[model samples]
Target: VANKGLKDLKKQVEGAAQDAVTAVGAAAQQVVDQATEAGQKAMDQVAKSTQETIHKSANQASESFSGFGKKLGLLK
Candidate 1:
């Protein structure tokens, strides 16, 4: 009778441990997904800012050269 009781206890402990492991695995996956999404958003913002900066610089350079040409009578 005591042996049977011990066996039942062991089974319960094993089942609980398995459940805990499954819960931890699921939580870890959620954390990984969140981090990946955040990283992608940051990358997108960086790309947009870089493109805007490049366009602004190009416009400035074009205006400067056009004004210089007009002053030298190379352009009307």
Candidate 2:
């Protein structure tokens, strides 16, 4: 009877340990998901800013190129 009681107690402890591990894993996954979402949001904002910068730079470069072409008598 004592040996059987010890076996039951061991099983209960093992089960609780497994449950705790599963909970930790679930919490970590939630954190990772949230972080990924935040990172993607930040990346999107950066991309927008970069695109705007590139567009402005391209406009300025084209204007300069057009001026140069006019000076070279290639364009009116």
Best by lDDT: 2
Worst 10 residues of 1 by lDDT: 67-76
Per-residue error (Å), model 2, residue 49: 0.9
Error of 2 at 65 (Å): 7.1
Spell out the clash pairs found in candidate 1.
none
lDDT of 2 at 6: 100
In order, the Cα lDDT scores of the candidates are 0.99, 0.99
lDDT of 2 by residue, 1-76 (tens): 9999999999999999999999999999999999999999999999999999999999999999999999999989
Q: lDDT tens digits, residues 8-69, model 1?
A: 99999999999999999999999999999999999999999999999999999999999999
Off by over 4 Å in 1: none
Task: Give the C-alpha miss distance for residue 51 in model 1, angstroms.
Answer: 0.7
TM-score of 1: 0.86
